[model samples]
Target: MNISLAQKARQNRIAALEYLRRTKQGAEAEGEVLNFFAHRAREKAKPVFFSVRARMDDERIAA
Candidate 1:
C-alpha cells in the first residue's frame, strides 16, 4: 500500500506512454504527453504538509 514517490512517477510515465500508444499519438505528441504527466507526477509527489499537522493533532487527542 505504501508506494514511494519515484515509483509513483514511474507508474505515471508508463501510464502516459500507454495512453499515447492506445490513442496512436506516440509519434506525434510523445514529448508533450510525457511532459504533462511528469508535471502532474511532480505535483502529486510533493510532501503533504497538512498530514503532519493532522498527525500532531491526533497525537494530542490520544494523549
Candidate 2:
C-alpha cells in the first residue's frame, strides 16, 4: 500500500518525537528531532528507483 507524502511526514514526526521521549532528551533534543524528520521527509520525497526482470521457463520453451 502507498501512503501520501503528508501522511508519511506525519508518521516520521511522530516517530521522531517518540524516540526523543524514549531517550529522555527532553526539550533540548527538539531541534535534532525536527532536523531528523525534515531530512526523512526530504528523503521520502525523492523518486523511487527499481528494476523489473522477466523470467523464462526453459523447460516449456524446449517442449
Candidate 3:
C-alpha cells in the first residue's frame, strides 16, 4: 500500500525512538524538534536485526 509523506515521516520517528531506546536516550519530544531529531536519528540509526541461528546437526557434523 502507498504511504503518505507524513506517514513515512511518522514511521521514521518511531524507528528513531526505538534506536534511542537502544542507546538509553528514549526521552519524549514533540513538534519540529521531534521531527528534526527523528530525521537525524533515523539517518544514523542502525537497521533492524535478528539473531543468528545455531548450526544444524548435519552442518555441525561436517565441520
Candidate 3 TM-score, C-alpha based: 0.37
lDDT of each candidate versus the true structure: 0.79, 0.70, 0.69
Deviation in angstroms for 31 in model 2? 21
Ranking by lDDT: 1, 2, 3
Regions of model 1 farther than 4 Å from truth:
25-63
lDDT of 1 by residue, 1-63 (tens): 999999999999999989878766754555444467767887786675768889999999999
lDDT of 2 by residue, 1-63 (tens): 999999999999999989977776654566444467767887786786544422235445666
What stretches of model 3 exceed 4 Å from their correct place? 25-63
Worst 10 residues of 1 by lDDT: 26-35
Please, what are the lDDT tens digits per residue for candidate 3 over residues 1-63? 999999999999999988877555433432234466767987786887544443465567788
Clashing pairs in 1: none
Candidate 2: stretches off by over 4 Å: 25-63
User: What's each prediction's TM-score?
Assistant: 0.38, 0.38, 0.37
